[model samples]
Target: MVAHEADYEYVIHKFETEYYTYDPEDDSEVKPGPNTPDINPKDVKKLPSSFIPEVKNECAQIFYRFKCPGSGLFHCILTGLVFDMTREAELLYKIIQWDESVLQPAGKMAAGPLFDIKCCEDAVRQLHFPHCVKTQEALLSDGLLSVAHFTDDAMSFIKPLKITDTHVIVDNPHLSAFGLVLDFLMGIWNKQVKGQVLLFLSPPNHAKQTQNINVLLLPRNIPMTEVSKHHQPSHFILVPSACNLIKNTTYTVHCPVANKIQPKRAEFDMEFGPNYSPTFVIRLPMNTDEVTLTIRDQTDTEVWEHEADLTDHLPFSADGRIPAEKIMVMLLDILEDLNDEEFKKFKWHLKTEVWNNISPIKENYLSKADRNDTVDLMVQTYEITGAVQVMENILKTICRNDLVKKLSTLRH
Candidate 1:
């Protein structure tokens, strides 16, 4: 065993098949140290017969020694006994912990697929490590049983997650859709561990500018030290559903490590692939913020009904003032009481008195019963507020008190 020093930098190397990937980012031959011996496959050896019992009993402290070409330093990792070897080289084998400011020395070991070691920080910052003593090796070894199926087989031996309790509170309809699946996953996870797993899923809300799944997993009864040795809270983007535009449509839940392991923060993606799980689809309308939404299926049956915004497509001010064209619709409804000659006389008075501008309403549109043309002209020529003021003046001149009241109520 070597003592760790604060001034020394530690480097971890991945062991590749061709050659131990001394430096994955670099691919050059490493020169040997002054007293270092040659490394060859023929010269590789195993642990002594005396240590066989320790290895078998899972009491052996295993260390992987390799040359680091990047910093020209020898690296030694204290990989705990009973590690998965199939994908060992790809794992982030360096284990350390933050002691407020600097990363304190923790045993270097490989956590299997079921386990993870991460740095937990509210904001992204570079992890600072205390100096440690560096150790190197000259020779290589073999005969360590490269077992790979340890974690997966162990987890598979237990029963999967299930929902048995009926007292679970499910208030949100969208969450209710995912109740069974969450119960299943939570059950399976809770069985392996002592704590209860809570998955909080917040779907995208266009009005709120939430365009992705914001899922958070909180482990009840689990210690912070245990959690710090595993995953950190992160934004897990999921595959969005194909019917995304339609409101209340349940999108399938797709996340990283969906099959191998449970994710602390998982994204429910909508992309199509082998990893796709057709999860629950909520029952609601496509446009959530609208005042009313009606969807009729091919059978003429209503599939969805929700409130929709009536003025969403209208050309009106943000404060609800209707444009001249919309005002014309209301005016026509009121003026239907006038006879054709009387309507003509009213238009002549409007053009000559109220609206004395060079560009006036055409005679034919006003003389005829259809005032669409005159309304369209007014919309283009005047602001809704100005047009309504002129309309109030015109109504007063004609002694149309009833029409004035109607316009007042319908103007906005």
Candidate 2:
């Protein structure tokens, strides 16, 4: 995460009390009387909660406090004035502390005490609102500290660290993704001497609420074990898109000591590539009406593209042999019932059920194929499991027990 420019400085203010005890208001901090004000702490109850009385004649030490309102909107009492603290204020509070130089002489040991503002007339505007408002003008006119000027001076002293948010394009391009994350981490840790750090590991091109797809939400304070939970071998694959995957999708696959495929998968196209590596290309027969591609890894474990979508290419294994025909056959059987509306309802229910498995609805990687679309188009994209389960349930509902039994036997 990048720090913002306003994060470096902590704002400090000093309040002068003319009355020993007084109520706080925008224009004044004393009783509404013609008599000049004076500081008398015996009437502490009348002071704002943020103010603290001096102890043992320690003039150099004063105290104050601020609060963050849930609305992100801050307002004042004098004619209901308002101002917003920048989001970067969080970093300021986290990194810096109050300085006591304002109260102490050069030789005295500074006790960093928070400062309070009198008249409450001072109003500091955020970066977004540069010009002074009516309340600020009132404070300035009285030679009183206005919030706007205080914020301006404090912000000027801030020097935030530069951070750049970027995306890693992984469309099966020539780049090796394995080392990218490691290098990124090294750069961040090495460059910044101190601060909170977070690294998000998003999923492969799946958008979620307010966040882009495939992005992780990692905070520096998060436990290491939790951070590892989102890790996947695929994160290291730098492909332009799912369809553009090639043998060199990741760097780890090319390790000389690693289990090697006799012929490199990169040498072939989608139709004839070896699936012993991270990716393979399969060329469906040009004239073929339907196709299914079941991919497996070196462990002989089948790989499922749970998030397959109409926009993605046919699914293939990360390694090992590709079972293209088996998936196609199952899909073709479903196409036989394409005209059935009840079958369409079953698909909707299935998608919803799969989606609801997570507490909040996450990105739906499963293809949203419509019955009105060509059977070939639907068959080419969806994973065999979700499509088959929806079809089998539909078949059973329509009293086609015979077909359901056959599907159960042939689920690959």
**RMSD for each of the candidates:** 31.7, 25.9
Q: Report the C-alpha displacement of residue 211, candidate 2, in angstroms.
A: 44
Kindly provide the TM-score of model 1 when superposed on the true structure, using C-alpha atoms.
0.21
Q: Write the residue-wise lDDT of candidate 1 on 265-339 in tens digits.
A: 232221111111212222222233322223332234443333322222223222211232345567566667666
Best candidate according to TM-score = 2
Count of backbone clashes for each model?
22, 35
Model 1 Cα displacement at 168 (Å)?
64
* Model 2 weakest lDDT span, ten residues long: 10-19
lDDT, each prediction: 0.26, 0.24
